[model samples]
Target: MPNKKTPTIWAIGDVQGCCDALQELLNHPEIKEDEHAQFWFAGDLINRGPHSLKTLRTIMQLGERAVCVLGNHDLHLLAVYAGIRRENKSDTIDEILQAPDVEEIIHWLRHRPLAHFDQNHLMVHAGVMAKWDEKKTLKLAAEVSDALQSKHWQKYLQKMYGNEPNRWRDSLTGSKRRRVIINALTRMRMCFEDGSMEFGSKDSPFDNKSNDIMPWFELPNRKTEKTTIIFGHWSTLGLMIRKNLIALDTGCVWGGKLSAIRLSDRKLVQVECTGKRR
Candidate 1:
């Protein structure tokens, strides 16, 4: 019998509507050689770039070969689609909203999970709370996923915006509970000493001068510390690869390179991006 090839898994950082860079990365000689390669996108797949519509469609066309978690920009697109939030002047998702198959697109986007676990790695768009282990993190993420896919999804979207209940509490329920889960999984960057999320800082952790806040991954006793946690949404932190962590966002929309790393051997691939978010 011919031996079956082991599929290569490429974990990609935030595309952020940079379809040109994304396509280039996918077409890189090393990546294209593996016809059976699978892609894992660390979300923010659209918005803030010149090709939001095409970028989203490209990933959607990948079908079962792609695994994408939800990022904050993606969730913002949903909010704008739901009429719960208005688009900012810099937003680039108007094309997607006006597309003929917008309903289908929204359906697909909303159904995406906030967290994904595979290949012995746990992936989320932002950061995981110190209190939750892999199993608990997936469970909470699923709860938000169910709410987003439910018949009254808009209601959930309406309640989704907020920074309250920053700390994780097992007793949290309803929108407050979902809010915490969504914020931590999608928008979180730093946390107070108590592990309550801090949303104001978008700068790199090293640039953080405050003594009270620390990057979520650096928090003492993170449950997923031993698990290989792959994430993005922190472009300022750039490409960070560690024994137990992979931070892939390289600010593609801000003229940085689009990055992808092979999970098995940690092979890195990158493509330069023209600045799109001025």
Candidate 2:
């Protein structure tokens, strides 16, 4: 019989180009040196902070020991890098795109899964749709992964960016279909009472009180009730501690701090973020 793989993991939140903060987090004492740790990122490793290339290279070097799901910012990085989109004047990913190791980093990043799972929990960039659960998600994520890893994938990645079909259904098609699924996995924010998701809600808890929409995790009778989900991409949601959900965005891109929670012991580690992209 094969020996069981030793389990050690640190499910970290969005890096968002915060290379310094990421360094601090990785060097944190609780990370445990003796154990072979597998790092899982909620993604968004570039844009809006700084040192995008350094951050990407560092993770790329880690290779299979680390896995990052696609965040909205990560998709944006790929888009800009692939010439499907242009970098804004305020963006800093050019450092990554022009780095000597840029192609290698992008190659690994472009192939990253949109969701990952091990024995205990599932990790995604934002939130998963209620209907798919973790197992189903990993399977579907593989489908998308195969699409991304294909030789002609640049066209697919370019095709895979947009927001339509706000709710999941069995019958969506073309780029619009792919884009909606991608957005939900990587960029979801709020949902209505009837379980319909809202793409327009980036507000903090105190920002709005219309009472018609709430964060997906806050929705009553959530479908993935039995599974613990670790997610980021909603800094507005901040550091949340729930019974089965770990929300670790921590506003790291908005002058907040980068955060990582040790899954073995639920230890939260953080480093102050300057929040400036340069």
Candidate 3:
């Protein structure tokens, strides 16, 4: 059964290590005063902005009041921590990696869900493949989450990076299958008509479309079309709000606003952000 959502639940966009902005957003008069509000973060909690450690700590401290999905950057942090991947030049995760409670933080972060479903909304860091319905998306996300929490979690990280087998298939197994699931749920922006993803097009769907490329959500016959799909990660798309879709990444770490949506009423709350822009 889907968990019953509270009336004041807020779905927040990608934080990207913008702790100050997150603090500002939370301290908004309405949000701060609402004791009944619960937060559902659309992920990218850490990375590419200052205060990655502080951001993680703050969200971690939220406990049951906040639920966060794992974004591509968040997973990269784990892979780097496990020595399966190296930190890139633009990475801002050193503070998190070198924190005193780094291990504990990683443990908690790795356990976060890849997809969160409730109140008829499915939240992911990026796009869901056209093939999966709500149940299948949730189940596939769990498979990745389970691997992240397993004894050989590092092994999964080793295979986590890559863009292959771009299309989904039930028969796919091993690292190949898991890679496709992780890619679609975390890094995807555009996809072909056949459901194969396009990673290069990160601009607005309106300006970037050709005959073969379109936003994943715009795919024909998408099974999860009936359920509202909430996502972040495509900051260039900014704060997109449609009847059944919300793309809330407003480029907070890129000097844009940090955005949130009150799920019950679809009210938007935005906070101006002055975080470092890459």
Candidate 4:
């Protein structure tokens, strides 16, 4: 019996393989399937961690009940496996590429939303640009989502392997334009004090080498600060619990734990991920 309260939806962080941990987390005693429950995954379903094939299969089985956004890693898997991206030994997309249901998996993955999760909160693989107000962010997300779904999607994916547009502007051009939007929705980590998106700072939050920069959540004039955000992809930031944001990547591939949070009441759920990127 589905509950009339719209089913307690939980948003989970990156699961770079870590299938065992994912099973454990989903099977947690508190998450009762008997009740109406839904889940939203922040993305990065494959690569780095082991058993990506198993992980993708599991997520696919969940069907419409699960809402997942596209993460950089997930995109990497699709691009490489599809021959649009170069193969890196660090990623585990081969397993997924060689999987029996590869067609369905990639099709579904490519079609996943780049951003705009739900009403109260915006879901993304990584943090949003502190500069992009909700309106701009939504518009950018729509653009990328459109490109990914178009027949020229592979062209966009091939052109996606870069860090050129380090900052956002209203007048960027060509691939630069798409890259800025892509980076913001996918690879962004930190931002300068003035809100310029920083593409290279992957250190722990304490090591703020640049006094002018801070994590997206730590930015000063965040317009979306009032709107809750659910994001993954910052394994370095790990699981940070705050009123306005929820950082869900627990670094599962780096031997950290996989985290899931029930959005209805914000209950904590977790799985222990144990697999090296190699």
RMSD of each predicted structure: 1.2, 1.9, 2.3, 2.1
Q: Write down the lDDT of every candidate, Cα atoms only.
A: 0.94, 0.80, 0.92, 0.82
Mark the 10 consecutive residues where model 3 has the least summed lDDT. 2-11
Candidate 2 least-lDDT 10 residues: 161-170
TM-score of 2: 0.93
For candidate 4, the per-residue lDDT at 245 reads 88
TM-score top scorer? 1
Query: Model 2 shows how many backbone clashes?
Result: 1
Give the alpha carbon lDDT tens digit for every residue of 36-85 in model 3: 68899998998988888899999888888899999999999999999988
Error of 1 at 194 (Å): 1.4
- Please give the clash total of every predicted structure, in order: 0, 1, 0, 1
lDDT of 4: 0.82
Q: Determine the backbone clash count of candidate 3.
A: 0
Writing each residue's lDDT as its tens digit, candidate 2 over 23-78 gives 88888877757357888888788788877778887788787778889888888888
Give residue 119's error in model 3 in angstroms: 0.8
Candidate 4 per-residue lDDT, tens place, 2-104, comes to 7657667878898878788888878888875634577788988878777889998888888887788988888888778658768787877787777788888
Question: Compared with the true structure, what per-residue lDDT tens digits does model 1 show for residues 146-255?
Answer: 99999989999998988998999999999999999999999999999889999999999999999999999999988999999999999899999999999999999999
**TM-score, one value per model:** 0.97, 0.93, 0.97, 0.93
Give per-residue lDDT, candidate 4, residue 177.
Answer: 87
Candidate 2 Cα errors over 4 Å, as ranges: 1-5
Looking at model 1, report the run of 10 residues with the lowest lDDT sum: 269-278
